[model samples]
Target: MSAADTKAVGPPVPVPPDPQPTGKSSSDDAPRVQKRKRKKGELLPYFLILPAIVAIAAVYLYPLSKTVIMSFQDMGRRELWSGEPAPWVGFEQFTNILGDPEFWWVTFRTIVFMAICVTLTMGIGLLVALLMRKLSTWVRLVLTVALIAAWSMPLMVAASIFRFMADSDYGLINTLIAKVVGEDWLGHNWYLNPVQGFGIITLLVVWGAIPFVVVTLYAALTQVPQELEEAAALDGATAYGIYKFVTWPVIKPVFTMVATLSVIWDFNVFGQIWLLRGNKPEPEYETLGLYSYSKAFESTSFSQGSAIALITVLLLSGVAVYYLRQLMKTGEVE
Candidate 1:
């Protein structure tokens, strides 16, 4: 063989590393895409919900913060009229309210009144809800319409209507009673009689509050499975038995939630008493709500009034916490 041919060609030239991938690859873009997606997901809900957060802050948080700050201060007419900050007094306002015998009595009476009103409201509301469930379509429609009318009436309007109904001489109720029971019962002043006075107020409250509870409970009832109800009937369950065992379990949570709400509402009721009296209500019939209003505006001791309101908030919050604990036990929420 020729010498040149016999000398082996130089080892095959080595290939250069493939030019580092010049264009972006799908894999290289994956992390960026995932991060962008995560950021969007995190921000979208907050953006979507921003208006609701703002509304809550405006309607609830602002007033609550103001009340809390006022409760800790020695606020009065000067602060209210001038919109100036009041002097801080620590817990003195609370201490003063708590130390009063009359305040204790008022608290006790208010509790009793709230309990009665709430019980009546719930009982009537539950009854109406049950009735609504069984009613024929037309009847249910009429009843619903009536309930809506009652529910939508403004608080002041309702108070005025109730006051008209309770007038000693001209009220429709008094007129009817007088007609039925003779001249002796004529002109019996309901507002002056403690039993009748409270009874009237309770009736007014229950009448007004029932519509909401019934509507909520009826909506919950509609969600119940008809198959389970039918199965229960086939098992020879009585109507009441069906309700107690099969229906109640499904609806109890809503019932409990409404009841708690009703308690808070009834406890804080002020319009009924005030409007009924056309001014500050008589102390004998006063609740914490009315008393607070009178103290703040009438007496201009804003701090003491705010203190009462704070106590009411604490009470309701405690109730809410207990309701939440019960809800947790039922696994209604995480």
Candidate 2:
């Protein structure tokens, strides 16, 4: 080879290395991209529910906050009408409510009323639910229709119906009782005595509440495993024993939930009593709801009413917490 040619090829020219990709590989970035998409997916549900949250805050939270504010102040008819601020009295309203003898009496009466109504509603509903399990398809269908019909009836209509049926004159109840017992029940003023008046109210409350209880319990009962029940029976367990051990454990959660809800509902009963009493429930017929209404609207003691209502809310919250704990223990919720 010529010297010049050998000189030209003295060394192979150094070439720059090919550039590597910057940052990360597509595989390495896959998770980050997926993470971004997952985050977006998570946020979608909250966005969907945002409107509901806003609506609920406006409808319920605002009034509740307003009530709490009013409870701290000595708000009355003047302040309510004038839209001016009321004098702040702190806990004086609550103190007054606690000290009042009539308030304690009303509390006692309300507790008793709730106890009686809850007891009857649960007991009768359980019995009805059990009976339904034994009924033929046709009869069960009939009962289901009746219960739904009763449940669907508006509170106002139900109250009116009950009122007419319990009228002092020309009442179907009085006529039936008189015919059966051969006693003069006609023109009997049920409201003359607080006990009798409360009895009627209790009946109305239970009648309205039972259908819901029955339906809920029935649904719970249906979920009980037939295999377990059969196994219990095969082991020579008695009817009551099987129920106590198998059925009860299964239905207990639902029963407790229903009972808790019933307590909340019964504690707040007002419309039926108000309607039955012609919009002026007697002091003897007064419950927590009615008492609050009486204080706020009738007496124009808005702060005191607000305090009473706040107390009721606290009590109900305690009840709700207890129910939630029971559900947790039963594995009904996490």
- Candidate 2 lDDT over 120-239, as tens digits, reads 999999999999999999999999999999999998999888888888897788989999887679899888998988888888889999999999999999988989999999999999
Clashes by residue pair, model 2: none
Error of 1 at 138 (Å): 1.5
TM-score of each: 0.82, 0.86
Model 2 RMSD vs true structure: 4.6
- Model 1, residue 67: distance off in Å is 2.5
- Model 1: CA > 4 A from native: 1-44, 78-85, 322-334
Overall local distance difference test of candidate 2: 0.91
Off by over 4 Å in 2: 1-50, 327-334
- For all candidates, the clash counts are 0, 0
